[model samples]
Target: MVGTAADADELLRHVDERLPDVVVTDIRMPPDFTDEGLRAALQIRASHPTTGIMVLSQHVQRRYAVELIADNPSGVGYLLKQRIADVSTFCADLVRVADGGTVLDPEVVALMITRADRDHASGRRLTPRQQQVLALMAEGRSNAAIAERLSITEKAVVQHVSHIYDHLTLPPSTDDHRRVLAVLHHLSR
Candidate 1:
């Protein structure tokens, strides 16, 4: 059972027919490249209560990670594809999933934990202005809107945002929406 979510309805038909042990899938797929694969996995697990589900992704998408493990944590596994490059390790993960063992990749685990600590530690490190800026950024506000909110110039907001990005070790990019994902990842723990 490996496919994108667009075909999941049809795939679920086949899965129902075949009754596979575990459904391993990526988190991105057609019909909107969101967490479609994860949703499909959940649907499969819901319809086929006995089936175990394992999800794979290149990065630790904490949002999907959280949902995938929402139920039957012991029977669900989330692994980074990089961690499964080795055939033996991948086989071991499959065996573990088949036997209802949660197989989280070490890197993903570390990232999830570290992000939690970072979110907890952030308040103590950021200044009041920085905190305001972060809240606005999390809200998908533009630098101009953030500046207006703080009664400052857009230039100042841009500078503050850059400082925030630098402090967070995030790449400097105009599309600040990525910070929302970063915050979600941090707060997810």
Candidate 2:
């Protein structure tokens, strides 16, 4: 509600003038209409690390999602435009991003999981339940949230996370966010 811009350049200008808690932008913008918004979003991320970003796309461009979260997975999101129809969920996603949580549309998460399974042998080692847990993790869901969604206990979710880390060969980290980023990076490849 702070301000709006027509194109990527204007968007950057607005951001430079006054940074917002979260920025929601399209993956495409005016003029070239191809990734201009994403480029601007990257620039903003570089300059304003505290500000959150959410990139909306009409199509599920897995590459763009990967790119957006490549350097820093926190306070970022990539969602399909259709997600906007579910206003409550969309608002929740924005708030989550603003609070330094990564958010990926479920469809995007599914695509990444599918691609990972096809491309990486390690991905094939996971059970369907583990894959579901991993997908929720990639969507920035905490163990409690994942457990609620899966109708399981938090301990079960924790065990699944441990197994996922072992299967993916991720090193032990005190930070959960780093683990999520590592999993996402693995899937992106």
Predicted model with the maximum lDDT: 2
lDDT of 1 by residue, 7-36 (tens): 556657767878888777777766676777
Best by TM-score: 2
- lDDT assessment of candidate 1: 0.67
- List the candidate 1 regions with Cα displacement exceeding 4 Å: 1-6, 120-188
> TM-score of every model?
0.58, 0.95
Write candidate 2's Cα lDDT for 1-189 as tens digits.
789999999999999898899999998999999999999999999999999999999999889998988888889999999989999999999999999999999999999999989998888899999999999988888889999999999999999988888888787777665566556756688
- Model 2 clash pairs are none
Worst 10 residues of 2 by lDDT: 176-185
How many clashes would you count in candidate 1?
0
Off by over 4 Å in 2: 174-178
Per-residue lDDT of 126 in model 2:
93
